[model samples]
Each structure stands twice: as structure tokens, then as C-alpha cells.
Target: MTATAEAHATRRRTYGAARLLLTLTALAALFATATPAAHAAEPVAQAAYLAARLRADPVYVTDQLPREIPHSTAPAFARLAKRTGVPTYVLVLPGPSGTGKGLLGAVHDRLGRDGLYVLIDASGVSDATAYGVHAPAADAATVALYELPYDAGPLRSFERFVDVVAQGSEKAAQRAASARERYGDEDPAALYLGPSDRDNQSFLTGVLLTAVPALILLLVPYVRRWRRRLPGAKPGRPGAKPGKPGSAKLDSGRKPESGKPESGKPGPGIRHRLGRGLVPAAALAGAAAIALTASLVFDQTRSSAAPPPTAADLTARVHRVTEGLKRDSVYVDPESARVLSAAQLSRLHDRIRAFARSDGGGPVYVLLVPQLTEDESAGQYDVFTATVHRKLGKDGLYVVADPLGGYIEVLNYGLRLDSVGLDLGLPESIGSGDDQAHEADDHALGDRLDALMTYLDKVPRSDEPNTAADYPATPEPVDSHVLRPLFSGDFRPGLLMGALTALFALALTAGVLGIVGKVLRRRNPAPLPTSTLPFTAPTDPSPSYLRRTAHTELSALAEDFRGSAGSGDSGDSGESGDSGESGESGESTHEQPPSGPSGLLPQVRAWDCFDAAMLLVDGDIDALDSPGPGPETLVAVVVLSRAGRAALRGEVNDLCCGVNPLHGPAVSRHHVRVSAEGRRRRLLPVCESCRNTAIVEPATVHTLLMTLPAPAGADGRVPYIETDGPLTAVPNGIPRLIDKVRETAGVQ
Candidate 1:
């Protein structure tokens, strides 16, 4: 009981004189504290007094100094506390207070009360504590700050907390509850445009970033058109006269001195051409991007609020089950999301013991839990079960079932274990003892496990060795038919952050490309579409340019080997496309003696190829002084430079990719349908990456072969590789190809 309660008790039990004396003493103490001398009291004494003050009024204010929440506001709060029906106490302290838990606990201890106590500092609800009751309102105090607008004061949060703490505050509680839900999840991005996946957001951002520079370029001409129409826009220009006000207007109506529109302002014909040439691809990309965004947005809004658990969480959960499996044959996750009835659990336990006693090849261990997210396992339910078996190192038929989906995954690990080649309508995993798993809401998961055990008891394992045809072929993965995770929930923070960073990079790249494209267009005329050949790309690198690059590299390598003063290296080569061979070759690994041209020069290895490459790299352009270099000879230098640079590098293995030399060395040779000598099938060396792609892709991989000039055949580009090509010399070493290029180019 409080001091006030004790005083009331005394008034009822004690004599009139004693009661009167008690009241007078209390009054004297109250008046004494009200005096100016009370200001000198220390903070500890003030805290003591603050606790005492709570007995009289549920709200206690520390000082009489100026406060945003003045001392007068305490009485109104006191009334609010009185209306709560439960005992509520509020303590208001001065500033510089760290955490409120201590003060709240100290005051509650001093008061010796079991009630809702809230400590309010100058900052706001410093802390809230429930002495002897469950109070969610304690968490609400901090949540209110986030719920309120950033500019909202602490008083507003304090009010919301009190409003939710008391009974019969339905109106306040409803508002508070909604705000609490939205507290941490408020979308902070300016481009939020409501709820949507990060991919969609990135797509829109990329499109905008890409289009911005082009849009700016397009606007420049219109801006110039407007400026030219303006009177005296540019002083002393030929069109706009200084003296005449109508000079600009007169010039606008006049025919052009050269018949073309002004530099910035293109005519209708030019605009149409630009729209046809430039706008279609951009518009198509924008439409595709927008469609992708809309699809994700539609999917996200309909999904759940919880994020799918990560692989680590699932693995941890499996480890938790490993302990349970050791103790019992039937291990069910008690805290599983898919709740099991007592009867269902009892039945499942009996079934497990029965299966263990059966004549099956291995004893059965069963586990039941909720369904996992499809993101990890599309349809393969054996991952967790396999993990459990690996951890336990047991030999038997182990079963893990999703109590939510009634899906059973059976894993056989022991050497004595028999394979169950059963298949229901489902078609991804090896076995399907999970009868009604494909059909939603068919049977309880525990009941499903019981049914599977009963089926296994009827079909016991055999001791005889099984042949290859004993089990059917493994079914193809039907991931599309499986239930994938809902996109509506918040993904893991790491994934979200990674996706955002990637999208930002993509947007940056798109912006750079846009700027580069605009600059290129401004510098050169947009080439008209071609009729006989492919679309016009005026900046495409010619074979001559590649020849110069090859010479530059070969010359540098020659100088580097000859010079011991410095370790000068050539610039990195890249894979780019155009004219003869579409893409440039990847850089060769050429160190001085071990890997570079110097490495091959020691034993006089590939000397003929190297000599021929050197001859073409210099002799064709310098000695003959003919029209630069032949496409065949130029491409030959490219081929020889790679082999000559590094004799033992992986890139030089198997004579590189026969189809595309730029693909680097063929990791393995693939049998091809292409015809060779005497109508026999041919084998072509291909890079591992390209080889893997060839298996799934129906179409053929692009060849790096360049056709010869029209003189060989009318508009028939006879590929340099096809004409006096190295096809015959491919399987054999590069020496024959070197001699062949020398014979063809006639470079001696």
C-alpha cells in the first residue's frame, strides 16, 4: 500500500487527534518542499522525493524549470492514467539522462508496487517497464517514435504509448497497431512508385539513365530552333539584324541559302529518319523493361510478408533435428510451424516403430516438419534429409516429410538399403512414396508418413544383387510445375543490397553508353541502311586496322625480347566485333622466357610459323609496299602471334578452336557432322564454354572465317580461311599453315 492508502487507513482506525496530527505533518512536509530552499537539494534526494510524489499523483515531474512539457501537464496525464482502469505511473525526469530502465526499476523498487511504470525523460519515453504483468506497450514507446513523422516531438510519442497502454482505448490502439506494423518497413526510396521487386525498379532506372543523354541531345536541336525564332537571340548573326525588330520573323519565312535546315534544327525528313533509325530499338527496350516491372509488381503485391529462410537457417534447423533423431526413431519438430494434433503424432510414432521392426533392408527413421521454400529446392526434398543422414552417419531408409505439404522424401544411405523405384504422378525425384503429396490438402503430413510406412512394410527389401535394369531411368527435373516461392515478401537484406548495387552499376553503364552514342552521332553522320549487305555501321573496324594492331604487338614482343633494359609490355587485347573476323582475340599469356615468343625461340620450336608471321607482319606492308596487307595474311599473323608468344599455355593447346580461333584452345575435341576427306565425319576442337553451349543450343556456333574479296567470286566473299585455308593443316601443327599462308600471300 502507498503512503496515501496508509493515511486513509489511519483516518478510519485512529482517533480524531492522531489523524489531525498526521494530516498536519504531511502538509508541513509538502509546504517545506515548495519553498525556494528546496532548490538546493541533490538529484538523489529529488529522485527519492519523485518516488514519494508518485504515491499521491501517478504522474511525477522532477523540476519546476522551463519544459516543453510543463509541470501543469502532469495533472492531465494523471487523469489519463486514472481512466486506464489499471494502475499506471508516469515519471518525467530532466535531460542528460542516458537509459530509462534503471530509473524505472529503481523507482518501482522504492515504491514497491506491481503496476505499469513509464519513465519519460526530456527526450521522450526513455523507457517503459511492467512490474508484474505482460506489457507490449513497453515496446510501443520506441516504435511510436518511428511511426510518427520525423518532425514530431517526443510528447506525441508519449501520448500514443499511454493511449495504447490503457484499457478501452480501442480507437487509439487501432491506429497505434497499424503504425507499429509500418514502423520499420516504410519505403524510403524516392522512386518507390508503390510496391515492386528490385529487378523491375532496376529496369526502369536503366531505361531512364540510358534515355536521358539521348533526350538531352534531341532537346538541343529544338532549343536551338526556338532560340533562332526569338528576336535578337544572337547578336550580329546574318539572319537577325540589330536595327529591325521583325528581322528574325522575316528570316524564319525565307528559303535557306543552301536549301538545308539550320545546323541544330533538322527538317521533318531528318526527324523521320532519326525516329525510324534510333527510336524503335529504344522504344522496344523500354516496353520490354516496363512489362517486366509490371509482371513483378503484380506478383509481389499478392505474396506473404515473411522472407524465405536462407540455406544457413535451414541447415541449422536440420542440425537441431539431428539431436532428436539420435534419441528417437520418430522425430517431429515440436516447434514446427505445421502443428500436429496429439492423435496424429501418436499414430506417426506407432508407425515408425512398426517400420523399424519390419523386414525392410534398413531400419526407418522419420522426421516431420513444415514445408521449406522452393527457392532452395525446386522439387528435390532430399537435401535436408541427406543433410541429416550425413550428420548422423546412419545406414537406413530415412524419411523427412513436410507436415504442411504432406510431401515425403526418403533417403537410402546404407549399403544394405533397398531402392524404392516407386513413382506417383510427380516427376522430379527418384522415389515417390508420398502418395497424395501432389494433390493439395489431401491428407495430414503425419498421416502421410504413416501410410508410407505401411506401404514399405508390404514391400520388404531383397538380399539378392540387383541388375542395371532393376530401377527406371532418372526423371527429368520438372521445376516449372513445382510451386515456387511467392515474390511478395521482403527478401533477405543481403540479397536486396546486392541487387540494388548491381542495378546501380547497370544504370551507370547505360548512362555512359547513352552519352557515348550521343557524342558519336554528333561527330559523324548516321549512315543510311544498306541493301545488299547488313545494316550500316560506319565506325566498324576494318581488317587493315587489325593488321596494324598485330604488327604493333609483334614488334613490341620482338623489342622486349631483344631489350634487357626494361620489361615493356603491350596493351591488353580485347574481344570486339566487326569487318573480317567479328571479334578481336583474347590476350595471350606472354612472359619473357617461360611463356612469350622467347620461350619458343630456344629449341627452335614453331620457328617456321613464327618467321612467316614476322614476314607478313612486316614484309607485306614494308618490303612489298603493296596495298597494306591481305585479309588472309593479316589473319594469319593473328593466329601465329598467339602460338609463337606462348608454346605451352592452355590457349595454344589443340591448335585452338577450329571454328573460332578467338575462342582460345579447345579443352576437348568434339565429333562434328561436318564432312572431311573421303566423305568421313570430321572432329572439331572447341573451347569448353562453347562445347557445353553446343550440346543444348540447336543452332551452330558462329565461325570466325572471313570471306575473300568479290574478284574471287561475284559478291561471293570467299573466306580467307576457305581460300588456301589451313583446314588441311589444322590437325597437323602450325608449320604447314605458315607455309600455306606464305604460299598464298606470296610474301616469301
Candidate 2:
């Protein structure tokens, strides 16, 4: 109940303050217009009273002043200061009378407690007819100055600072509600409701801190969604435009593009066909999505707002140093910005002055340029004046700039460098998972360089501005976050934002690629082969009975044809064009036959012969096992007679051997053995071609077939005779043929 009551009271107080501020503003305006110079005195007197009261406060005493005041004015000063407790200085008009001294004494007594010390005893006032007792326009004026750390930036233009406070309060309430939804009725402390103590300083500071992140978050999605809907959305979407300017220009008097079919047309040149393969596109999309999600989840915008150094600012005591040299000024939540206090402000100012005054003050000015929105161009986001330009007079201001494009050029250059990966000693960092983090950092650095260039460019056009240091250099210990890199150090918000942007790009690219890839893969494709090749019979075919008869007949037929052809001419052949024994030659007396068996001879059952030969060679003759030599023990040899060799002399060759009858073996001697050792030899069939000449190998001959007399006067077929022999130097006939067969079978 106490907390709630306190909150309520705070709200009421803010409201009252806002109302009072508004009234004061109205009265001031009225006085300016209606009563003129005479009317300004009341406000001046009121200001003086307020300043006196603020100066006497206990909070301002030891901590602010550290000085003593005259005893005569002590009581009055104390009474006034006790009422306000605000620290402020009252500017009094120089006077020779004791009244002026008394007022100064009273001011000294009250404001002395704080640093709100008065500058009085100025009888040497330069302007004789100033805004004083003489009531004349002059360069100087007596005024009351008060230190109120209430921020009245772009967030709140009116004097109603309370309105800004209210906005923050409302946001806090909403956020609290959101927290409730997510974490249930848990303690608010876990939510990090406000900084340390929920005082005005905490509240204001918290709100300021939260604004930027909130704006970035709220704005980015809005941009993307709006961009997506641009081709489809109605001109006026029937909702309030909010803070957008000239938005109505788009809706009025403009013919919206005709709506296209719901078939969602993508950007120009994007093909409807899905050409990208699934695996690659899907993988890319997944990666992109992950990156995007991470970026969004961890976005922090603070990294984008690091303050730049200025030679003039370093020497100026009128400066305010940022708690962190953070570029971001916006807050993620309003409540976070509401916590700024006068003490904090003063400290910031002192630090800034010290920093600016460290080196000799040159023509330099400090600036608190706020970040621009996404929609605003850099030009539109330019700073209009130096420090507090709109409120305080422009002379001797911080953040001073001439009326030229020099500063803007510098800023743009910095942006460019930051984008292109140049480092300019600025505190910028790449966001985690950000594709363009490096680029952004580069651009920021470029912006600085560009700024320097612009400054150089404008140097000739303007005279050097006055420079002075307002404070001494005093190094102060900063928080780890402040001293660390912009990304993860003190301000992670900026880094997070950068990451999110990169991720969004990745996700978008992936989505697009995925959509296209799926479609493309659906089109042209090379599918896996349907089924495997039909199985072939095994090579070992010597397991059956009926095969022997067929094999013998085929073998006999081959012998008969070869013999008839005279071992040279392609005989009894139908017509396979001109034939010649085109193959390797046998060594010594006999000539080697053509590589292939005679397949075209009519008398020879050619196919049957080949089948039998293959069976014998593959040792599959067992598959045809009937009786006798079983085709396994049988060894066949080609014997070239002298006559048969003559036939091979001409191009019309009938024999497998490349020999002429004239070149045949010397005698009609024939004996062959299967092995060199003469272990196996049998009475095998022999053709007349062999008998015509004595064709015998000396090493192993089991038996010789008698040579047949010249085939019955030339027109007769060569006789076939049986011979006994085992296979000897099995001719180099079929190795190539077997290799082809193996390849077709997919063997190694």
C-alpha cells in the first residue's frame, strides 16, 4: 500500500509540475506581449526567489558549495532555500545601494550551499540601459538560473516536462503488464522494473535509456511490413498515421496500382519455376533464419551512437560529458529515461567540460546530436544548432556549426567509412552474427574521415571560431560497460540492433532462395536408374548331361568348315565381303590364326561352336557333363597344311590363322598334348587342313592323324579326323574378347 500510494503521489506531483510549467509559460508570453518591459520584473523576482530557495537546500550544501555566506542574509536565504531545495543561482543587477548587496548576500547564503554561486557586485555593468532598473534593451539581463536535470528534448518540446514523465509512466505500466503475462505474478524486481531506487532521477534516466531500443524495435518491423505490403495495401489503411509527416500526400489524388491476382507476383525477373535444388536452398534458408532470429532476439542499438571528440569541446567548461561515449540516445523503455537527476546532469556537465578543456581550446564545439529515424535521410537528421540552441542563446554554444555543408559532409564520410570497413579510432563494433557489422563499423569511421575532409573544405570559407576550456581535465573511473567496446561492453543494445538487421537480410535472402529452389528442382531432373540389369548365367556351366552331344557336334562342324576352306580361304562362306586373316602370326613353322572363330561359315554351326567354346574355356563344360573328354580334357589345335596355307596367302582368307598354304608346316606329323609334360592327350577330331601338311609340335604329341590326300581333285571337302592331344600353349586368341565380356558384366 505504501508503494502504491507513493507511486500515486509521484504521478500527482508530476501532473502538478506540468500544469505549473504551462501556466508559467503562458504568463511569460502574456507579459512579453501585453505588459512589455515593466511586466518582466515579476517573473524575474519569482525566478530569483526560486533560485534562492534551491541554493539553500541541504542536498546542495556540503556536496555542491563547500563555501560560506554572510550571516546577515543567512536566515532569509535558508528560509527560501528550504522551500525549494533546488540548486540555482540568481543573477542580480549591479547596484551601488545596500539593497543589491543584501540580495547578493541572501543569494550567496542560499545558493552557496550548492554550486549555484552568484556573480554579483557588478557595478561595472557594461550596458547602462540594460534590462534592469533603467528598463532598456541591452546586451545583458539579470535573470534567475536554476539547475533542473529534467530533460526537455525532442521527446517533449513544451515546458510540460511532466508530460514526458507521464508517457514514461504509461509505458512502464504497459511493460509491467507484459511482464505479468510472461512471468506470471512474480516480483517486479526480477523484471528489472527500474534502476536501483525508483526516484525521479532513476525514472528519467531509465526512460531515456529505453527509448532508443524501443523505437528501433518498433520501427524496423514496421518498415519491413510496410515495404512488403506496398504493392498491395490500400492508400489509406484507415488507421491514424501517427508521427509520420506528409503521409497523407501518398493517399490523396494518387491512383493506386491495380491489384494483381492473388498469385503473388514477386519482384521483377524472379522466375516462377523453381530451379534451385532443394538441399542447397533449404540449407541456406535454415541458416539465414537462424541468423535472423538470433539478431532480433539480441539486438541492441546503443552501439550506433558513440560521441566524437572535438578540440574545442575539450577546452570548454560549458560541456556535459555523456555517461558513456555511446552513440545511442534512445531508450528501450520510457521509464528508463525518466530517472535522470540534476546531480547526474551536473556531473555529466563537469566531466564534459573537463574532457573538452583537456587540451588547448581551439575553434571547437561539442554537440549532442540525436540519432535520426530510419525514414529520415542524413540530411534531414542534421543538427540545427549547438548545445541547447533552441533554448539557450546560440553564442558560445557547444556543438557549433557554420551555415555550410561541411559538418554534414564529415558526418556522411564517417558513415561511408563505417559502412566500408574503415576504423577511425571511434568506439564502434560489429554486432554478433551481423553480416554487415564490419561494414557498419567501417562506415562509421568513414563518417569521421569525411567529416574531417568537410572541415578542411570549409576552412577557407570561414574564420576560426573562439575556443576556450571551461573545466580542468580530471579523469574519472568509468563502469566496465563504458570502458568496453560498444557492442558488448557498456552498451550492448546497439550491437544487438546491428546483428538483427544482418539476420533479417540473411533470412530474407534464404526465404527467397528457398522458394525459388523448391520450384526449380521440381522441373528438370535426373532420377535414379529404375532397376538393375538382368542377371547373367554363371561362367562355370559344366554340371549337366545333354550338353556334351551338342558340344561335340559343334566342334566337329567347326573342323569340317576350316578343313574345307583349306586353312586359308574363307570357305563355304555365304558372303561377309572379302576376308583376310587379319591377326597375330604364330611363331616358327605355323602361322597364327585370326583372333575370332570362323563365325560366317555355313557348314560350321557358328553360334553353336562359340557356345561350346565359351563353355569349355569358362570350365562350365561340367554343366554339360555327359561322357568322354567332357569338353574339359579336350584340347583343340589348328594345324595349317601347306595347301591350307596357300589359301591364306591371298586376301580371301578362310582360316582363323594368318598363313598361306605355301607357308604351312614342313611335314604331315601331328601330335599334341594338353600339358608340356605330356600328362594329358586324347584322340581328338582333326580337320583335313591339318592332315594336308605335317603340323606337329615337337614337345608333346600323343597321336598323329594321317594326312588326307589332296581333297578329291580340288572340289572335295577336307576330311575331319580324330586326334589325341591336350591343350598346349593355349593360343593368345581370346584375352581381349574376355576383357570386353568382363566389362559388360561389371567385374573388376
Candidate 3:
């Protein structure tokens, strides 16, 4: 065969390999998309199903409420509802802009509670109107009073109205067989769904919109496969020049001989077919991209087309939410609503203090809003407020209208304001002007935001909650919490984790394709005759090439131990030549990695691990020391760093790890050695030994480690210092411990 034919054969082989890869990549992407579906909406659906189930239960009841509320408010509502036989309505508005709309919605919901299902009809009512209190009509089957903030006097009047209604109903019941009969007939119970509930449907809609496109992208490549075919052309005519059209050519990064269709004689081998398969794979990948793009565009268009929540719907929702407010304990602004006496204020302060202790932080806010009767404008208070500062400035309450929302925003920004802000100083410009003061106040509130920030800093979280957020610098797999001990960052170190995943996939694909490629090559080997093309060019003989590889490897091994690095390098004169070779590259082939003395992992520094390990070794050790473990065991907890944790994890699985494996090469092969005291002793390093006896206080070690970020070695080589001698000889001997064990076990 001519040189052109030989080159054509190589081109065919190259195409086959490319085809296989393209096909595999497309398949893998589809698989990745399908697998995450099980997790999609899993948390939301679970939360929704739980809510629905709770709603269906007889004991499950909800109250309508204002957007902002005190922590101690929920119980008061329940108690008031039980004490008074009138349904309560809570009027909650979105903000200053929607006060009228909010109030009307609250009253509408209140009127509908007498019916069996609490039906609400916002049919004719305009969304933008302040609420009114209406006396029930004379002919109405059951008397119901509509109560809300209608005017300057209505708030105090509403309270009086409630008292009168309660009294009148009791008097009327007195005429009945007994007071129990009256009480039973006028049961005061109502339900409300807050703005959160009203907006949940919208949230669900948004989720569906986001997810549907991803699902469609997953389906594309497979659906379009059959319609796509490889482009084909016939081989050149039999007598035509070798470089004719319909020909294939190959260049091996060297000069190409000529172009020609390699398939002039017979069918290509399996390798050639596999190589050609790349074209189809590439086509499939393109289809996947198009499908994903189209789906995203469609989703965006649909999202844009959807209308906002209707006013009537919102009014009805607000009403249903506010009905429970009547039964709730009323909150009068600290600055206004003078009806709340000194005793009430004192009681409120006590509640605030108790809440602060329970929450493990300072009171975040002491919100004071005037009732409608006091002054309509005083009802609104935001982060930016003069009265907010007046009421809470000295008390250190973080006054914000939407405490939770503001907190969420600060947390999302990765600003841990709460844990670090206690010592922070206030800016001088904060109290300059009313508006400036308010802006400063807003910033201060955000700066001091704690509750949400606390959750992010210490709480173990599932990524699903904030999956859409930017990923951290580290990559960790999402797995079950039960396996959290085993799945640590140290187990799979560094930024390299992201690329490890891709490489794993590539390796798996290559392994699968290699087998397929071999089968195809067997039937149709390379097209050109073997004698026509020389198999070898003068480069290096295979044996000599392997010998050189062995020499390079030996040089690397010798340089593994070097002076001023490790103790093993002192006498190894043979390493100098290899060290020189490594130095020429300006990058060390073997650099010393930081480890504990003798490469032992320091467990004592980790209180949790040390305490746990001690407990595992001997239960009687605590009793031998002061304060037995029965009570003291609670105080001891084991803590471990990432590296130490990795060692502990391996130990749990009965694998060689930490000092046990590392000591052999780092220290002497033998465990027994002489110490500085001139006594024969087992050289159990500080990393492997407990700082105190087997019965050490968990807190003692933990506090010590937390204070010292890194361990102190004799000469900076060790991660931990030897604080105490190893327990080579047990105190009072093995026999004493055996006797104690027998006594505890109740052996005669």
C-alpha cells in the first residue's frame, strides 16, 4: 500500500477513539442530572407534607399574627383564647405602605370564623381601605362583632368592647342550665396563616419553575440520538489518484504523506470504528447544550409571564391570619399606650430578661409600636427609628423591623456579626442627625445581628438549604450525617478535590472504552501492510529507556532523606548526587510535611478524642482519680482537629494510622528506648500519650488546646510537647486494677 493509504488508516483510528469519548461524556452528563432529582424538592416537600399533616390533626391550630412579634407572645394567645370565649383577630400589615390593605384583610378574616370552615370572601371589598368595627345585625343567626383599628379611639375601645362582650355572654349564659353550658356554647378558638403561609404558594411556584428546565435538559441527548447520523462519503475511484476527494488523511504531529480514503481494500478494524464513533458523541453533546439553553429560556419566559399575587387573595389571607389576634395578649408600645401600668412594664422586662438567657445572647430588640388609638403613624417602626433608639439605645437591643430578614441578609454575605461584634465600637457619625442616626441604626442592627449568624457559624447544615449560594473554597461531597465522622476534609485534602472527581470519571470512561476498542481492533487491524511502514525510528531502545526510568526513580528515593530536614539524612552520602539533580529543577522532590513528634497525631489536644479514647481504654481510671466518671463523665468530651480526626476515623475502622504507622519510619524501628533520666522506658511520644493520667478532665485538656493554636515541640519538629511521662508501669500495678475491676463487676 502507498504512504497515503497508511496515513488514512491512522486517521480512521483517531476518529474512532474520539467518537467513543464523546458518546461516554454525553451519557455521564445525563446520569449526573438524573441522580440529583431524588434530592430535588426533597426538603421542601417534606416540610410541606409535615405542615399539611399538622393542619389535618385535631390539636393543630394556628393564629393570625403581625409580621413582627415578641418571643413570649405565642403562649399568651393560647391562654387568652381559653380564658375568654371570643375569637381573637391579630392585625398584621406588611409595612407602612400596606397598612390599610393589611388592616382590611385582617378584619375580613375575622368575620368569617363563625362558619364551620372559616370561609372568607374578599369579593366586593377593595384591597386599600382601613378596617372598621361593626356590631352584628339583629337578625344574624349568631352575633359576631367585627373588631380592628378604625380610628384614634378604636384600639382602647376594642379592648373595652371585648370586656363587655365577655361579660354580656357570661350573664346570658347564667340564664341557661349552668355556667358550663354557656362556656361550652361560646368556645373562643380561631386560626391564622401569617404572611409566610400566604407566600408559600408563590415559593412553590418559583421552585417548580427553576427545576423543570433542568429536568428537560436531562432528556435531550437520548431523544435526539436516532435523528443524528455520521456524515459519510464513498472511497476514491479504483484508478483515481491517491489524494482524490472522499479520502482520509492523518498527521502524527509530523509531516502527513498525502490524503486518501483508507478504506479502499476492506472494512476497518474495531479500533477504527471506535475512533469514528467520536463524531456521534460530539453531536450528542451539542444537542444537550441546545436542550439546556432552550429549557432555561422557556422557564425564564414563563416566570416573567406569571402575575403577582392578587390584592383580593392577599386581603383574604391577611384576614384569616389576623383572626387569632383577638385572643393574643395585646402589646402596647413602651413609649405609648399608657394603659399598660408600671407592673405590666416590669413583667415585660422580666420576660425579656428570661428570654435573653434562654437564647444565650443579649436581647436583640425591644420593639415599641403605638396602637391605632394612640396614633396611627406611631404604629410603624423600622430599623431606622428615633423612638427605637430612645427605648432600646441604653438597653442594647438591636432594633430592626424585620429582624429575621435583616439577619438572613447579613448571614448570606458571610458576615459573622454576632460572634465578633460585642467588642466593636459604635461609629462617631451614628447619632449625628435623625436620618443619619437611622441609617447608622440600620447598619448597627445589621452589624449586631446574632441569631441567624450563630446558626451559620456553629450549626451543622445540609447544603440543600443554600445550594444556590456560591460554593466554599473547599469541595465536600453531600452525604448523610451519620457518616460525618468518616467524611472529613482531611480524608480528601485540599482544592484538588474538585479535579479528582473529573479525573475519576475520565478514568472510568477510559477503562470501559479500552475493552470495546480492543474488540474492534482484533477483526480489522491497522489497514496498511506491516512491511510498507517501518515500525520503529532510531530514538532509544525499549530496554535502555526502561533502565533510564529506573535510574530516575532511584535518584528520587535517595533524596527522600536529607539533612536539616529529617534525622535520616545525616549519614546518607549517596543522596548528594540525587539532591543536586532535584535542586537543578528549583523545586524540592521531597519536602518535609508538618507532623507531630515521631509523626504521631496529638490526641490529647483534642479533648473529645482524648476523653473518648480514655473512656474506651479503661472505665475504672476516672474512679481511681478524684470524682468518679458517673458524674464526671459528663464533663469530658473529645474534640479532634481535621488531621487528628482522620487518624481517629481510621482507628475506628481498625486501619493503621497516626503514630502507629508513622513512627516506624520517623523514629526507631524499636518501641523500647532509654529516656533522658537514664532509665529504660518505652518511648511513647506525646502525640500518642494522654497529657494526664487515663482519668483526665476533658475540660482541662480542651481549654489548653483551644488556647494554643499549634502544639510546641522540643525544636519545632514536634506538634505536641511532652507534658508528662508515659504510663509504662501502671500505678499500683496490674493486679490492683484487676481487683478493682472484679469489685465493680461484682465477682465473688
Best by TM-score: 1
TM-scores across all candidates?
0.30, 0.19, 0.19
Best by lDDT: 1
Which digits, one per residue and each the tens of the lDDT, describe model 1 over residues 1-748?
A: 6999999978787787888899999999887765323323222343455578788788875431122344445665676666445688887654423142256666676788878887765446767778886555544674555565442434555676766665334554566566667766762222112334444444444444344434444433444444333322321121221222111111101111212344566553554466545544664565466546645653432122112333352344556678888888777554222234445556777776666665544567877654333222333456556556677878677676654455566655552334544223223321233344455332345455656666666553657523212222222232322222333233344334545554565567557656765674443212121121111211122555445535533433232222211111111111112211111232211111123352233213333444456445332223212345655555566556555444311223325555444334456776543322243334666556556645665144332222435333456455333545543454344555666655644534
Q: Which is better, 2 or 3, measured by lDDT?
A: 2
Off by over 4 Å in 3: 1-342, 346-511, 520-528, 532-748
Which runs of model 2 end up more than 4 angstroms from their true locations? Answer: 1-340, 343-605, 608-622, 625-748
lDDT: the better of candidates 1 and 2: 1
TM-score of 1: 0.30
Shift of residue 19 alpha carbon in model 3, Å? 99
Residue pairs with clashing backbones, model 1: 706-719, 707-718, 707-719, 708-718, 708-719
Q: Model 1 off-target regions past 4 Å?
A: 1-196, 222-315, 337-360, 374-380, 415-420, 423-443, 458-748
Clashes per model (N, Cα, C within 3 A): 5, 119, 34
Q: Residue 560 CA error for candidate 3 (Å)?
A: 57
